[model samples]
Target: MSDFRDVVILLPGITGSVLANAAGKEVWAPSAGAAWRAITSFGSSITGLELAGDDADDGVSAPRLVADVTLVPGLVKIDGYSRIENYLVEHLGLERGANYFPFPYDWRRDNRVSARRLESQAMAWLKTWRERSGNAEARLVLIGHSMGGLVARYFIECLGGWQATRALLTLGTPHRGSLNAVGFLENGMKKGIGPFGLDLSPLLRSLTSVYQLLPIYPCIGTGAGELQRIAAAAEAGLLTHVDAARAHAARAFHQEIQDAQARNARDEAYARNGPTLVPVVGIEQPTVQSVQVKDGRIELLNSHDGSDFGGDGTVPRVSGTPIEMGDAKREVYAAEMHGALQNADGTLANLRGVLTRDRIDFRKFQRAEDAAMLTLDVDDVVLPGDPVAVRVRASEGNPRISVTLTLVATGEAFDEPLARDPEPGWQQGIFDLEPGIWRVTAHAEGATPVSDLVVVAAP
Candidate 1:
């Protein structure tokens, strides 16, 4: 392996980490078998995974491992991060568990708890690697996907991790926050797949991180320009689950990071040599751009045209774009889904560039200017033994496009070319995919290929 002494530590987004109970039973993980079980009896199957109180920020939640579980209690999500792990090992010449491994933490609690844990572990690890490799130049290269990005930033900015970090690269992270989070907290987590669903509102409403994921942007208001603060939404009875105190604290968490960053910028030692912040944004997918309060509940609005606001299907561009992202050294846009971004080709390439400083032809990534904005018609979550109906419609009129399905577990391609649909600007195909996570890709002739993730739940 190449003697690249840089210590690489990856952080997974919310739900990207695995959690177990006091009985040592793995409760939170991605499995087709468990997925269906959780779907049907989710309220019962996943017991003891809930937190103690609604206000995690009220006091430091020091839940013991398997007891209170208020601390870091999980691993790098699931096998999905393997694609990323393998890429780093192969390209960066790093060894797993030696210089590269994911920071596993309980995803159900306060993000500050995770950030603090990351601080202690990352600093110690960096010191060890520096001395072992005899490379004083060695520093931390943190790669966070989704909410994991937020956790990493909190460590780097809020906790003084900038001193030892070489770079902090984020993929499809909702920097501001996601309207999807608001939808989840407002209506509770729903599978939307027939009756096989979970009313996780009770469990979800108590999460500080879930409330923190609410859109910091102008969301809860009329479709018009008039918008109110999230705290106002709570006061007006627009929110059912999230309370005013939790909503304000969640927003404050984001502000704390920005405030810390500003302080670091003013501090000479950090200002001169701060960690390079590069957030890789996902584009060209249907996403929740805004929400409206209808009656007593909040409703999410997805303008499925894949605009900048369309974001990466979950995080809109406005949210993913860090408020303090002032001319980052490296910035890229990939046409991929929120779930698939961690392993997307563009994301991998950008990571390579950030780690090794290899000259990348950024023109290749910016071709969306000439490329068609493709919207893959597929659900983010699917049912077991169900025929997934895949459709692709391009912004440019009837364009020649191809569709393909690839199993994420094996990296095997199962191509299902489409036939022209009766409706204009669309091509369609149907495939009976087994219970697992599958990547659905739609390629337009002479344009960038757009993709999304479809998880076939288990029985």
Candidate 2:
């Protein structure tokens, strides 16, 4: 067993910098790689993992735990400057200049080479860290953001064995890949631009073709070629094997990636199969149309698509929680962009809880001035005099909350008010009224007011 202390490696997403900077003795900014390079031309005494070198035999071993925090293309970046990063740091007690893992390239390109390169680099780093730390039994905890989550899974399934690594905590990872890739590829073709405006390497094109042929988890590929495939699939209709292959390929890819990681690792320190998959879900506030189930698929209903079945303007709920490996845990939070997972306190708490497996009450760390509305549903219908209950949830400070129920019967109005609770979730209230149309308004004593409309039938 290595004597080295437990290490929490932070892996940054595409175009992401290390967690913090060098100021205030708190390292945030640029990202781990950039930070590492900037601090000194020479490497730090702190154990480091690099994706490009012949540093094997340096005593590195498998089963190394990882924590990925990389950015996804077409999604918001979570950096120290971003509100999401601030929220996560506060909630997770993360230091500004700590050692965290980061991805080597962009995941938006959907290139298997990039994925493979990242996996190889992470594996080497973990092996070396384990050997150097003298803790062969040490576990790896991977926290991936957006597509970085998928990359982490691929790594574990491809290399992690039971003897190495522990768990995987994915924040807004698209295991099945994202439909947005289709759009990106299409737009690129129209502009005569290559993948991200760079030429598509022949190997990359081959990988893309192979991805499409796979029975599961097919690669969306990068650039114009991928766009053509998407169009072909649509033209072939949803019934053809081509379409089936595309769908199955994506699923299979996730399964296979996981299966590969499970097959290669040592079985003692880590689980025999793939690392445990934990999905973090995001929701937007004041939007009753945030979630939807269409064509048997659960999606995040957002304003961008007007279909009540998209995502927080970028990631679809189906893509957000795509992996189906092992017993899984889910956490939901309020935020619009996928990167918001980093800043949403509730989301960060849940992530920390998963990594540490310790019980943490998020309510204790609540901030003052945080407020959200609570809507009640009674038998799938909104009706007056039907025991309508509403509550106010605040982050901090005592806010006088009131609920006013107006009954429009015989041109008469009756108002009833309720108290606000400073906790998360819902509170109940009872109301009985004469038959008529009723409008209910819930206003916090010192905050904004929210109202709902309900109708009651005459007996």
Candidate 3:
């Protein structure tokens, strides 16, 4: 009998892996000492140190940085992932280093390149599983979070990873793109009230992975208030004074993967005989839906003007759970924020729930229309005197969209005007309304109307 029946591999989100040097220098990974240094140093003076892996001069060019670094699976310790890895070993009764593995990678690199490393890891695990069981057909299970999910997808789709894997479960992966990455490139980090306030623009642009996270769809609008493709915006000179070479490189990488996705989706054999894919997405969290330049800097704004547009904070629900995976197994959760979904109770429960069953739901999903949906990306509850952020966004059509919020319980309604450029195209209004059910609607001249419901709960 085999000691290990099936292997479970865990992949971390962005910046979730730890990097250490022989001299005891640590970069990226969070620690008590790192936090103390951050509080004491100005800007990234203490925490902004770079490692060799972050260097893009390996002849990889602007967009696709060459993968010259090797990541050790055992040498990683990310806070959120460590907790979940422990749960798998202790609570799930999975043996560590035998049936369970945590895969850490250089998250700042291209995802497709990272997928090659994941392929190597999966093959080794599969070989071990087959040897232990005397069965050469055993496969592996992959649990990827954030960018890790993209890596897994690339392995399965483009690299024939489906042949060596059994199932894939992704959490908070941005299948489309994240606007926050664009914001980071444009505005950099807002100089917060602290000793560490510094311009993060230089650092954010240096990472090839951040450019990979740019929006793939036409959700972002240009200064002229027209929703255009990200590539189009870049070509039309929307983003200025940025790294053009890196952007081009990232764009080529994105196009390649998208073509791979389309090819896989069209393949009958891949769909019928491929590994099972389950996407668990979070909704009702306020995520950055759009970004623009304001006051000579980039401004990140929430979609639907901050309505619950359906995401876990960083990745929107629509982008996280891709339409391509509509027929695969799907799980939806509300109120789970980003960064902590790996260790969240609800996520764990869902993980167990999926494995306990042998069959997938195989639900068919349709691509949502541009104007068919609206979201009130706000909290469900608020205190009496708190300034509630009211934002509304549409799924499609024009960027010059208008919104009207009505406190249905009080029969009070008001139309909000669209905020000027550099701000998002949607309208945002802050009000201290009485606790009740509020209805928000978004409408453009040529698009259909959409609405979302929000509850202002008691404090």
Candidate 4:
């Protein structure tokens, strides 16, 4: 009789895995020291990591998820994962390798490919765990952050993984896709990564996974503000690298999974046999809702879904839940960022709560369209010790809004009630820092709080 009966597998988003080459040379795994060196010549690295038609020539592959990605207690660490792996062991009381496993895959390939791989690996893993533990309660609980959730949903809905999966909790998964991805396609992948960003357009274009990230909704608008012909994206000047055929097929992949899920929902047998899917969506942070293409340039803009709800900085709140899973008995929202949701306090609490039946009430953290967004006009990298400009915004209707920055190192914090900005319906603040990592949270009256990570490094 094993204490922990479920096989809990954590699937990471794109870039969450460690990719290597044929000679076992790591092509992509941005640890602290490696990142500085990689940034300078990342262009050449992209060549090795690029996808190829022939598997024989495909040099890049993911060996494992970056399990060691963490921020140890002390020495002014950069913005790191919320320590999700530790949470499982300490808070959730689960042993690694016994039940908790991280499913890492080649994120550059199509999600369908990864989903199929999951179906096979998960089956074998589950069988082995069940036989060893001899526990009738043994099952599979999948926790997916970002794009990993898309892969999990595809497996459950389209590849028959639902037969064994008990629950799937998705953190900030973009069910309808993101405009940020559109921007990446318009430009290149690394152009968004950091300061010395390279335009790896050719390499990014070769990845089937990137094409599959195209927005499913009609988010593309013309310079003239015409939003017609949304799904026919290949014609969009911004998506020059992605051919029309690939664009259409990517949309079809999403549709196929959705259609399969609908059929399962309609089937009476599915109710008893299907897995429980819970989407932990983040809201009220800066997120890309739509894009306008002008003269071969893609510009991202944030807009509400007409319901007044916001989204994680990467995925719109409107696309948080798949249509099939929208009607879940409990609908919870958080104020975490897109990348950090896995280790977010609310997310971890919720996961623990779901397991022990003692989850925290996240209703207080709900973000309303009125005051649901906080924006920081800074990239991942900045001049060492530079003061970052922070912008906080709410719907024009918001009566008041405030900003708070908490030093992750010392837990020291300061709150600033922002003054109105020159732009209507916006407030601004300048955050002066002392070489460390900080977490910023925006609070508005009667609205859910919005929080994100900001790193201020020393020279």
Candidate with the greatest lDDT versus the true structure: 1
Model 3's TM-score against the true structure: 0.66
Q: How does each model score on lDDT?
A: 0.75, 0.44, 0.66, 0.73
Clashes of 4: 3
Candidate 1 TM-score to native: 0.70
The per-residue C-alpha lDDT of model 4 at residue 269 equals: 69
- Tens-digit lDDT track for model 4 on 66-128? 654443122112233338877877767677777777888888888988898899888888888
lDDT of 1 by residue, 1-459 (tens): 338778899887777766666555566655655555555554364544667764433222222221111211121123367778879999889987668867877777888988888898888888888777888888898998888899999999988889889888888888888877777777765443455545566667767788778877666675555677788878868776668888888889989998998888899988788888888998888888866776675666774222335688888876667887745534588988887788888889888877776445454466744445678889888777778888888876677778778889999886667888778778888788888889999987756688999999997
Which of 2 and 3 is the better model by lDDT? 3
How far out, in Å, is residue 105 in model 2?
A: 2.0
Q: Which stretches of candidate 1 lie above 4 Å from their native place?
A: 40-47, 54-79, 190-197, 223-225, 303-308, 326-330, 358-459
- The local distance difference test score of model 1 is 0.75
TM-score, one value per model: 0.70, 0.45, 0.66, 0.71
Question: Clashing residue pairs in candidate 1, if any?
Answer: 13-148, 16-77, 32-458, 63-70, 73-106
**lDDT, candidate 3, 351-410, per-residue tens:** 876665543322212233233444446666666667667665555533666777798976
Q: Which model scores highest in TM-score?
A: 4
lDDT of 2 by residue, 1-459 (tens): 322233343444443432221222222233445333423432221113211222222222222112234332222244332444444355455443231343434322333444566666556666766666676655556666665666666566654432344666666665545544433322221211123322222222222322321222222222223222333343445212233444444455566775665444445544444356677755552221222223423232232224344454445554556444323445454465665555567766676666555344443344343244334333223454355445544434545555667765555665555543345554446667566677766655434456666666655
Q: How many pairs collide in each candidate, listed in order? A: 5, 62, 15, 3
